[model samples]
Target: MADVWAKISAVLPGSVDQFPLQFSDTVESSVVEILKRCRQQLYSDSTGTNQTLYPQIVVDFSWEKLNTGTWRHIDKEWRRVYSYGCLFKAAALCHNSPSAEELLQAVRTCDMGLLMGAAILDDILQVIVRILQGEVRKSTKEDADESERTEVKRIKIQCPHAPAIKEELSVPRIKCPSLESFNTNYLLPLKPVILEGIIDHWPALSQRPWSIEYLRSVAGCRTVPVEVGSRYTDEEWSQTLLTFSEFIDRHILNKEDGVKGVGYLAQHQLFDQIPELKEDIRLPDYCCLGEGEEDDITVNAWFGPLGTVSPLHQDPQQNFLAQVVGSKYVRLYSPEDTDKLYPHQSQLLHNTSQVEVENPDTERFPEFSKAPYLECVLRPGEVLFIPVQHWHYIRSLELSFSVSFWWS
Candidate 1:
């Protein structure tokens, strides 16, 4: 029994510790619980039938058989390894059965030739940890990434998790329409519209080598907060503070692989951080048509490499998402489809839905299929109007830079 317990104790701790996300409890006993349920079903039955039902689980599993005809010890500790597949499935059939918990006690207290049990104990615990537990935690690393890493800490994630993006549609557009017509046709109706040839006059567009090199020259020394991840919804995502020059060096200049996992300078008040850079661009005239003061119109920067995503969500105020550096694909859905979008119930995330706009899960969020949406490939010198309460999704198609204004 000591050898069996020692083997079980050794592997269980390592498996729990190696799991990626922070677990509710480090010592997971789901497999042990499942095994107990399976045992009860086998022994306790109103009908005297010896038939036992088990779940059919498929896995690519293989392991060494211990204490056989020609067994050799791999190490000095004489640890025995036993591997089996569909073992968890048989146990998982007890997911919510009324079986009393006794297998764990039996396994823990079993002294049935400790040496023989030792051979199988370690592998059994490992299989439970690496196979069974791994199955349940496999999905939605993106969910963990978006809500906790980049989002405001006040937000909380609830069940029926956010939907993923699954469609791409075209958004409507106009070329420098009069402010009266713009308000009459789109703003008042709370609709999304794209404005063309809007930022053609900005000096930033004409700067010599206005690529990564020029950006480094201007705000290189400025310290700013950047979102470091391939997408905002990546599990490994987080926020970091870096000098603008250092950011360009580590995330841009030094980048060799691609734009999959790179740091992004986004939704930041770069205009306020480095006022000198603010001289390069001008705010659209459309903002003046609204009731807010010019000072009240908040301008924020969204800059990152290709593949960066701001998952499907809604904002509180009217927005003019102006593209200055590279192109971005913007998707817009009307507030009327709010129910289909599965907006978060929390007040902090209430303005945003849980659904991802790029790879949506129709089975989980079937109503999302019924929602109508508009999308566009926004290029330099163009601005996208996102009316207040409108849900939208944004993704960079290349290394991109843009400014957004939030106004009521």
Candidate 2:
């Protein structure tokens, strides 16, 4: 425990110094004020009139009060609170006995800070987080990198039976075309195709397959945001944070006992938050074909149980949806079928279609029946390329883990 505290202490000086570098002078001053107030409130023993609210609540209010401002400003303020709160918590651990509650709080605070904090502080805070969680390195960083490069083993993965959907039109499948060929054939033409043999060498597919147990072991205690409800289209749908273990226990494993609501950890840059998991998969070289650099590509993780749905919607960037663990049934419609799809008129849902593809009511949306579409059951180790603005509907056929790379 002393060693753990020492590790955390070493990271604090660097993180504290880097916090004010990226923002304006005004933001830096505000951060100093917040840090001073938070430190005083947290270390205060008396519930006096001067400090009536708890430190955590005060920090949360500071974050929530800035909601109306630009998102950039709000994130800056939020990161200061979380990052300083994390530092204060780590300091407290040095003087007192470390409790599980305190350690968990420190871990969560650092996780929140990383969501929108200075890039310079990221690696420092990440190391602090692992130390507080008592996660030991299996090997030195150098050894781990060398092993990953040389010791990749491809083993057979037993995938569930592909869902039975009569395909009137199927997306074309290409077997690992060269990047130049891919750019000329698919990217230029704006067509959707599934490329096989692209992700065969990923450690996630071979050495460290993303089973429930494997995920639990590596990232069980890490904090992550998850969407709760049947689907995002539902009125009750909302997002919440859950530990990876809790998400699996309540949503994935508990589904057999007939769990009611769905919990999806969707559209999150989980790789940035958990670097250990990021090492298991390499970014596809094809992302270089985009105008932006590889770092500009938006990578998201989608993990959920069977039957979770991403209703028919389109994105603004070209996407590479890589199936890692289980199969998913994907149905796509070209932008030419936009009028036939009956997109929602509301500003919030303008990009989403109102009609559900599988069980569309022909009376209400008769044109949807005539909308020509392509469909496929995407399997593990396959990468599905979706062009910009192409409408896609996806449903998990089994417990699934998928990663998507979106780039312009």
For each candidate, the alpha-carbon lDDT, in order, equals 0.58, 0.74
- Residue-by-residue lDDT tens digits, candidate 1, 259-348: 435888884456753555688888898887788899899899887766678878877889999888767877888888899999878875
Please report how far candidate 1 places residue 199 from its true position, in Å: 1.4
lDDT per residue (tens digit) for residues 1-408 in model 2: 435555655665444333343444534465556566655544444344433233455346545644557765565545555455555544454324345665666667667656644333455667777776553222212132443223211112335567565745888999999999999999999999999999899999899988776787677777898898868999888888888878877887662376458999985669978887899988888888889988788999999878899999999999999999878999999999999999999998999999978899899999999989899999889999999999999998878899999999
lDDT of 1 at 98: 12
Please count the clashing residue pairs in each candidate, in the order shown. 16, 0
How well does each candidate superpose onto the true structure, as a TM-score? 0.56, 0.83
Evaluated against the true structure, the overall lDDT of model 1 is 0.58
